[model samples]
Target: MLVRKARLPDADSIHALIRSLSFDGTLLPRTFAEICENVRDFTVVENDRGEFAGCGALHLYGPHLAEIRSIAVTPRARKQGAGSAIVQALLAEADTHSVSCVCLFTRLPDFFRQLGFAQVDRTALPDKIYKDCANCPRIHACDEIAMARGVLPDIAVLGPAQVEERLIPLQL
Candidate 1:
């Protein structure tokens, strides 16, 4: 299998893969337009035959934080190291951008733990809270665990004050 930065032509496959997982809320649903608009953020894995196997995206909030989102592998590609390769490639991309932290929300903590992520309080990720969690359909009943690799950012650019204020009651 091979992993590489996603190209425009890969958008349909990536959209389908993410949509397949989103049906049960395994991931947030993304429109095909969203995938195309942010296609540069995605990395895709292809089987030896050069067929699309899986994909993941790295959304950089800044030098302070980057997020791994929309990560999913086709059912047939599971256990073939495609997922791991995609993640490593994303992390490398983060490193190239000098991002200090990488975060993700996942139901599969064990999978990410093996990849060097540790559980972190969702509130500790203010930028994420502001960007997605604040309006997430599952906000009050979220099942995904927040995890991070590397030092958590000390600051947030997107409404940190508002995120903190809103999250306070949730923590209580």
Candidate 2:
């Protein structure tokens, strides 16, 4: 398998991959336009024949914190290491940017735990809760667990205060 940074042309495949998995509510659905806007945040894995197999994205929340979003491997491609490879690529990208830590919300905590991630109280990440959660349809009834790998710099001092001040206090 080959893994590489995603290009603009790869957005459709990436969107389809995530949409396929979003059926079970394991992932949040993303629109084509959102993918286009954040195309640089993605990495994809392809088989030796160049078929799109899996994808994941690293979303920058601040200089010190990033979130792993839209991670999914094609159902036909499971158990072939596509998911792990995509995550490894995302993590490597985080390292390249010198991000202090990476966080993700997943039902599959065991998968992330294998990658050195530990479960954390979601409440500790007010920035994340205020950004995505406040607008998410399932925020009031979220079933996912939060996890992180690497030591995060104190996010309060890492710029989240600005985010908190701007929060609109939506009821989600």
Candidate 3:
């Protein structure tokens, strides 16, 4: 498999792969427009024949943090290392930006763990909480595990107080 930065033409394929996994909440749903708008954030993997195999995105929250999101592989690409390639590529992208940390919320903790991510308290990622978790439908009953790699950012660019307030009830 070959991994490279996604181009505008890859939006539909990326959207389709994400949509296929979003039904069961494996990923948050992303509109085609959203994918197109953030196409630069995405990295795609292709089989030897150049067919789209999988895609992932590196969402920068300033240099302090970056997120790995919307990663999914086509059914035909499963177990073929497409997913791992996409993730590695995203991590490489984060490195390019000199991000202090990389984070993700995932059901597949073990998969990410093998890539050097360790479980982290959701509250430790205030930027992510304020940006996505506050609006996430599964906030109170979130099944995804929060994980991170590299030094955790000590400063919260978003509202940490508000994030704490919102997450308090979940801990109850």
Listed per model in order, the count of residue pairs whose N, CA or C atoms clash below 3 Å is: 0, 0, 0
TM-score of every prediction relative to native: 0.92, 0.88, 0.91
Off by over 4 Å in 1: 160-172
lDDT of each: 0.93, 0.85, 0.91
In angstroms, what RMSD does candidate 1 have relative to the true structure? Answer: 5.4
**Number of the top lDDT candidate:** 1
Best-performing candidate as measured by TM-score: 1
Report each candidate's C-alpha RMSD, comma-separated, in the order given.
5.4, 3.7, 5.5
User: What local lDDT does model 2 show for residue 19?
Assistant: 85
Worst 10 residues of 3 by lDDT: 163-172
Over 1-172, each residue of candidate 3 has an lDDT whose tens digit, in order, gives 7899999999999999889888988889999999999999999998999999989999999899999999888888899788887888888889888998999999999999999999999889989999998877778999899999999999878785776776677644
Worst 10 residues of 1 by lDDT: 163-172
**Candidate 1 clashes between residue pairs 3 or more apart in a chain or in different chains:** none
Q: What lDDT, from 0 to 1, does candidate 2 have?
A: 0.85
Candidate 2 lDDT, 1-172, residue by residue in tens: 9999999999999998788877889789999999999999999999888998889999987767889999888887889888888898888889988888899999999998998889998877666777777667788899899998887547643334655666648667
